[model samples]
Target: MNGFLQEKPIKNFLQSMDEFFSNPFPNSAFPLTVKETTTANLIIAELPGINREQIQINVYDHHLTISVNYQELITEENTQQNFFRSSQTYKRNSRTVALPYPIDEKKVKASYQNGLLTVTVPKQKGKKIMIEES
Candidate 1:
């Protein structure tokens, strides 16, 4: 019984690692939150050190996609008259979210401020269906 339990846990751990490595954008993943308002659905994404010009937002087939490409610069100075300069260039990341309710593609709007990306998708009004004789 003890051996069986240990084997199961190890198997589960290996499976989890495999799943993690299977993702293409493992390091690019960030935090996000979804919320629903009375009139629209809202998605807030936290993206620090990313410029607005480097971000793109798109809506297609009830899906919202956010893509970002940025460059990170690292500089180090040493007291022994040595300097190190390194930069990570053109790193790209994207995330897609499915909208719960239908939205007007033309009315979709997004704003970024203070490292927060806010996307508002206005809900589409559905026509009422009238039932006659069955």
Candidate 2:
């Protein structure tokens, strides 16, 4: 009786983990590189087999978020045996970065080429505010 109770929880845990890993985005994190320059910060991410339309980027409260989702469909047929099979695969990932210093979000730029994503964030210039003597 005790063994049955313990086995149920173990099976449930394994099933949950399988469901979590089925979607690669939240389970696996991709690799990236960041470089800082005098005027701007550059970020490079490696994303192979992904199209520009499958990716999304957003900046809010000094944080930059990059997300991507791609799907591929495959179908196979056997004429002699009269067999047909169809399968689908999906790849996804998301990454968020925190800027070291304040950035000019309006001036930020990004580009994707050769399976690499590059983002340039320009630093915000300090504006001097004049104080009047009372």
Candidate 3:
């Protein structure tokens, strides 16, 4: 009982903190970090255990949403008792980000690789500029 059982609370607290910082969108959504540049806006989110084909990306008006569905097949195998237990469930998660300005839908692009989803929404020319004459 002295090996590692005393650190359960500490481990749980650290995990909670990690989840808080890992996601930038609403608490219910997947997690995304947005970086703004002079040329374009980059949105990055990690969707582990999700395949590229099961992901959906959409850009509408000034909002960007990415969704991924994961099918979990949990199997418990007992070799000693020669028995097996299987459970299947599907989890769906989607994250939406609001942009500072609207963009041309046709100019948007997205790429998914290595369990990482990258959504790039290029800033439309003069999209964020407001003209004021003195």
Best by TM-score: 1
lDDT of 1 by residue, 1-134 (tens): 65764697787987788898887556766778889888888989999878899899887878888888767777666868776666666677888899765656789889999999999888777789999998
Instruction: Tell me which residue pairs clash in candidate 1.
Output: none
Per-residue CA lDDT of model 2 for 1-134, tens digit only, reads: 65764597787987788887886555477778889899888988888877899988888867888898878899999999999999999977789989866656789899999999999988777789999999
Task: Name the runs in model 2 displaced over 4 angstroms.
Answer: 1-27, 101-105, 126-134
Q: After TM-score superposition, what is the CA distance of residue 39 in candidate 2 from its true location, in Å?
A: 1.4
| Error of model 3, residue 88, in angstroms | 5.0
- lDDT (Cα atoms) of all candidates against the true structure: 0.82, 0.84, 0.81
Question: Against the hidden true structure, what lDDT does model 2 obtain?
Answer: 0.84
Once superposed on the true structure, which residue ranges of model 1 sit more than 4 Å away at CA? 1-26, 72-88
Report model 3's TM-score to 2 decimal places.
0.61
| Every model's TM-score | 0.64, 0.62, 0.61
lDDT of 2 at 131: 100
